[model samples]
Target chain A: MIDVGGTEGGVRLRAPRHRVARRAVLWWSCQAASRVVVLLAAVGFGAWWSPFPNRALVIALIVLGVLGIGYVTVMPWWRYRVHRWETTESAVYTAAGWLSREWRVAPMSRIQTVDTARGPLQRALGLSSVTVTTASAAGPLTIDGLERDVAADLAERLTRTTQATPGDAT
Target chain B: MNEFPPEEATAAPTPPPGPFEDWQRLDPKAVVASTALVVAPMFPIVAIMAVSDDGSTRTLTTAGVLLGVVVLTLVGSWLRWYFTRFRVTAERFELREGNISRSFRSIPRERVRSVDLTAPVVHRLLGISVVKIGTGQKAGSEGELKLDAISTARAEELRRLLLRPRAGTTPESATPPVADSAEETGTELARMRPTWYLYSTLTASLLLFTWAAVGSALSTLSDVFRALWAADTATDWLSDTASSVWTHAPLWAVVVAAVVTVLVGGLLGALAFSVEMWWGFRLTREGDATLRVRRGLLTTRAVSLERRRLRGVELAEPMLLRLAGGSRLTAVATGLEHGETSGRSDNKALLPPAPRGVAGRIGALVLERPGTLEDGAPLRAHPRVALRRRLSRVLLPALLLASGLAVAAHQSEVVPWWSWLVPLGTAPPAVVLAWDAYRNLGHGHRDEYLVTRYGTGVKRTVLLQREGIIGWRISQSPLQRLAGLLTVSATTAAGNGYYSVRDAEAEQGLSFAESCVPGLLSPFLEKNSEFTSESVDSLDGTSHERAKKRTDHP
Candidate 1:
């Protein structure tokens, strides 16, 4: 973990990077599964005992499996490759995007609060996600993929730091 | 003690036992009082339905009465309990309530911008007042420090602390000592035109009553016509009235008198409601800092607001009010939404209740100018930005409309001429809007303060000092990148509202904002990099010390 506060009453603490990764997987998995199920059902009904038959079914199944594998396997790899975190004395910046990349930097003083959340997959992986909220309505900035212990420690530290430096920028 | 000046000696006198340790719970009676307000409005329908003789309607009315009684009683009791629950510690004021998913809020004293004390007749008699501490957030955010059922003395003391100018924060020249002469002068409440004010405000109630009366009369007229169409006995009664008015002199006089009496009665009903609404309207300046407002008959409310809390001031001149140059001024305070001067308790107030001249005075006090509406503090922008804005506004719309017309003309066989007219119609407004936008836009700086103002219809200005700005962002679109234009926005803890300046200002504006709002953009604007967690070590103690030096004011 980076010492964000340094020596000048700066805020230090953020959810670990891995917890953010697991959440990204879970969020996309739900989306992918729904799309896959719909596609499979449509294929099954549309091809049901057609005259062209066995060879086509085999091809279709192969294609579906490959697609599912690609979605589950390839996407998480891309996210893990892209996901990054950096902390400054004043804020935490996390960037995640495949092609048209984006970044979110939330200043420690500006952060009103930090919320830690864990999904079933994340719990299994011992990971958690953290969301940093500011007074603005743009919504909270989220970092996924943190080890559970790391998540809790980060939350505690951030909470203490924020309370200590109350009325600062964040 | 050795011969130091009084100011120097009093520099650190214990900080006033901190943010008050004792906080009163909201009056238990308030639940009953507020619940009555919510329930009372619905009761009139029940009374009307119950008295009506229609058989099915009467049965429904009875059932409604039974249902309303149960719901009202249970909810009212629960609400009373919920609001009355609170605790105040030395550091914060905490409120815990809500049936499901209990909500709790802790408001610190430093965050409090202003403290308001209000009381109804009953609360006054009970020697308790409801205290509202405005946290400077916009409507619908929970940061109020409310202490209900408190004595007036405690309320006053708390208000003084909250209203007191903080050392090293408020400019030394901003607030001078209150003049003793002015403070001693007090206006008698009786001197205010309570009756005339009530009569004028009754206009609104009268308008509502007239709406109902006119609708009822029209329906009754339609019913009479329907009865005549069916040749019914009710129709025969109407015919008799017509015949009497036409033939018999005395009967005609009676008919005319009765018609006049009904009209007068409807008008009188309106007048009564209006009078009831604005019953005891009174306005007075309590202290040098606050304007005290007291009004209402059943539930009298007293409002004490600091002039500094006022955001935007408006002067409304209704045609009738305008005839006598009798303009009503309304003020919009930062956190407050309702401006019901008359404790009419009806929540739907279009404008704030202020004195006829108070809006101008309050406006001057808040903005340092009267009549001329000012927005946030001034910011800096390049002159070339106006040209870009004009181009975007005038050219974009013209291009889009012309293309759309060409596409329509090509696709559709009919209305070829109309399609070509699209650009012609859109051109004028686009030009005007762009011109207005150009004229209204400006940015400036007064040392620590970065002010930005823009808008044609309702000119909005946001004043953000380096200390007040929590964060900021500067973003450029593909078109904007090519055009050397950037949109920069700064967010403040004062509320979720952020001020923005677009098109005209780019790098300079953003750099200024970035300079003011520390830690907005950082070591993270990396090019062609992914999550490079190189652990930002550049922001050291020295940087923070520098930031503090830049931000701190004496």
Candidate 2:
């Protein structure tokens, strides 16, 4: 029985303080490793196809290697810095992204389902991601990089809230 | 409405042999009408065989085979029509059909969302219409039920009965009450205006005409080239005369002639298309709390929408249409999914292109409210940094194109040196468009409703009911962070499900979302004394005054 339209209209709200687990950096690095492999494969194909001299191929590979190494080393830290999430009684707020920061709020009543998932890498790192599905065209709101137990707790809370609130599902 | 006899109504009760007893068949003329489909394809095949060089024996065999297929198809259609039977009981509508594989479908009285009636030219001539019942379900064929041909009077009566609000909310207890208390008379909401139709036709027809003219001219040019290459001795005097005239005509005159021809053809096409599509467009509110729209000339249509399912109204104004002060209104109602194959035109359009003010007035009438969401307090504009962000976004593309052209010119002569200046030439228009987009960004709220306006090329102002908004999404990019801006999206079940307000100050967007739906975001909002005191103090006074005025006026 929360009042949804009776609050003061101009206060700037602060994002939650709970940062993603430190193991998230390891998880991100694992993903970056796959991307690095793809990039190297692409560079190798370019070297084979191009009519340019071997010197040009060598220079291209060297530059690509440096960029790839930089990305693998730095992107994880940037992603960890921006990732933040919190669950309230009526809604879940998540702020994450590296170059483009996205802050999304999904209300409990609108949530159709809540799922907690643990990938092979995430399982090894004791991390999980929680996804809340709604009818919104923005697609599902996912909060990645959470401790396994925390993700489970969030999923349970979301499901309970969705059931308690009496509203149309879609 | 009282066309049904009393004995027929009381013949079957609950827990009987079946829910339906007085089953009825479609109009007999339906078989004849459907036979056209079977006969249409055979005509060309039979003609080709008749004109073939093959002997009379082969031609006779082909004709005999075609005749057999046609006869079989006609018999199948007749049998199918005979087997299809429908019955309207007090609690549900039962449809029994199929000869080889008997199929039975029943739609509960409470689950029906709409009952639409359509009559194509042939059906209209036979004085029969098709009735389709829509249920808000995703099940394949169960979601919609169609009776191919039924008497127009019966269709109207069934529409009224099926769409009538049930006595209670639960489906189990739903039973036909005594006749509806309200009279059958409906209040006319809107009809197509001649001027609006003209503008609508002109907007689309002009483009069509241009394409047609270009296609014809290209074909003619190709024909002349082909004739010249062949150098046939059979070249007629008419062609010789035409070639002489073509050579004598100035290039400017030819261009002018083509342009004139395109414009005239476009105008004519627009007029014809508009007249055909919206010949008798009419929207009315039937007494049973259903909004019914009847339109189309050759193929008449009648679609009814229960008021309970309507989410809101969307006013769309495309760039050219906006310039002419025209807007289109569409109803965002559930169960009226804009599917690819189903020609459910009436389910979407509430009003065709019309004066913006007229569309607004009709929107208000459809919602049954004196003041709509747009009538609330003036919309709040985003921070000035938003304008800067948009301008940079526009400039970035232009800069990239200029650099790309420069690189291309340096590599090869394929690109002209002057092509690098193209970005500069486009800069002014891009900047102007960005400014317009920024100016259009706004969000506001009224009692139980939320209003959002945005878009540069196709401006849209939506007035959505607050209850329909099931969730909210707030996002910010890196560039947006520098500008202290965030985008807020209100998620609903209708239309695109998410309507966004772009480039608002982080604090402003959060506060706007919180106030629009109070407790949903407030619990998570960390209220700092410094920011709250500076921001909330000013906004509080204006919002309080507006809320008070709304209450008093309402």
Candidate 3:
């Protein structure tokens, strides 16, 4: 957590109040590792049956393996540093993405639904994701890699606020 | 707010609402129109079968099937006409439809946002039209209702009634506001110009359309020739010409001739299409401030939109059309868009490919303001790094590929000598394209409208209303962060859902976003409190805030 706002208003865009749970880094790395493993296995099988020369295959393998290992090692930590979310009395705000940082804000009156979902990997890691949808087709705001209890509490509070508010949401 | 008497509310949960009015049914002529439309395609099939000289049993069977289908269609349409009925109420519009699995649909009158009337050639001949009532809800929800084959006059009346405020609903307001008169009158806004068809020929879509048509025609012709194996005379003549034509002409000559023919055919096709599509194009501000567009030669369509639902206008200038000083106009209004991936929806077309001046003028008029697109606030240019990024997007990949090709060429005699030059040869054009795209990236505001312009092949300028925006999104890539550039998007329910100002300096974009929607981003900002507000304000905070929200929504 980086605290940039404390009774201070300014021109710069401050990070959201709370960062994603620390375990999110491990969870993300595990997910990436699984993908890398699957790719490696696929490459090994392809190389066994491939028509290409040994020299070419070796070069390709080296390039792919290095890239995969780098991605699996770096992406999770980078994402953890960038991802953050907060909910105020009037709006929901979130910052996400590893290579690209996307900051989103949805006011309470415009929010149509608040939903919480859990993947198998996330369930194993005791993590959940909360999605807040508005009428705009641009997309919903998703806060991934939150602690299970925190996500549930956030969803509950968001649902209550949306229900209390009045609008057509369009 | 329940308009029905107290006893009726107690009697039934969903009762027929109006006692003074009788239930109305679709025009009976719809049966004829429906039969004609369905049977028209089968006419050629029936004619071909009749003349084929096939076996008597097969011919008779085919005729029998056709007759049975027509009879089934007639019975279905009659049943539909007999069962369907609708009526207006003080607060709700109720409809009952279907004979087998009946349904009663009721919509609160105040929820209606648009009432459209469309009539195909056959329906036009019978003086009936299809009325679609949109409640402005997204994704064709329960708010959408359709009435097929009603008298056009009745549809016009319904359009007026549905759009105008009710009599007692605004008793104190009395008449409508000065700007929006509560009367059933039309103000002519724009009309079709004959010379505008010339610009249609300059569109890339004309080429696409003609190419598709030519391909299908060629394939169909080949299929017919293959089937005519027994008729040597037809096949022999075609084969003789195909074999000898190329022998007499050089390859370059043939290519030139083919290109010329295709271009000519495409232009002619575009001309015919433009004329038919916009034969009597007329845009008008009709009863209760609803915008109505009436067009088409054979199949006239009357599409309507509520003025309140209009969010903005989009001006599209495709490369060729822009070169010809022609641009297209589309309404960024709720309930106007239909179907995903449609790309082109005439219902939302305020003006076809016309002069750019005309498009901009009409767009401003529709926005209900008299200022030009850049009246007060000139569009601010994106950072120079944005252009550098665009150039790199093309030059980097091209350079890398060119180097690889050059290395491969040096290593082998089998590699073509020209392959290395190909990427380098294309770089100049790509550079030009990147520069064009960069030049087009701009964002500004004119009074109540926020305008953004982007793209190269088809530069689009969107003039979106500030109040219509529901949310905000700001994004920055890793590379952009290094360059201090970010993209800010305004999310609204109208026109593409979101419009972005791409690749602006971080602080410049944040401040622009803040200025566009006053308080929405202020609370989220953290500066010296110079251009930002510290604490978040609840929408339902106080009487003052509630009043501000009321004004904002309206």
Best lDDT among the predictions, by candidate number: 3
For candidate 1, what is the DockQ?
Answer: 0.11
lDDT of 2 by residue, B1-554 (tens): 11323444433333222223357677667877677657865675566555443565756876788789888888988998988888866677888889999999987777787788988877888888989898765443667899888768667766776776765543333334224334355788898777877667645534575567667966865574353333243356658876787799998987888899877777776676667667899998877478988888788888888888787888888888888888878887766764333544446788878888888889988887785435657888888898998898899989999999999999998899889899978999999999999999888875766788889887988878788777777777778878788888887766566778888788778877777776777655654453322122123234334423432353
Docking class of 2: acceptable
lDDT of each residue in A40-149, candidate 3, tens digit only: 88877788788865767667778889999999999999998878776667777888989988999888788988899999989999999999988777858998988887
Give the range of the ten consecutive residues with the poorest summed lDDT in model 2 chain B.
B532-541
Clashes of each: 28, 4, 5
Model 3 stretches astray by more than 4 angstroms: A1-10, A51-55, A58-63, B1-24, B49-58, B79-88, B93-106, B140-144, B166-185, B213-236, B338-341, B528-554
TM-score for candidate 2: 0.77
Q: What is the C-alpha lDDT of each candidate?
A: 0.53, 0.73, 0.77
Chain A vs. true chain A, TM-score per model, equals: 0.66, 0.85, 0.89
Q: Score the docking of each candidate (DockQ).
A: 0.11, 0.35, 0.34
The prediction achieving the highest DockQ against the true structure is 2
**In candidate 3, which residue pairs clash?**
A9-B529, A10-B526, A10-B527, A10-B528, A11-B527
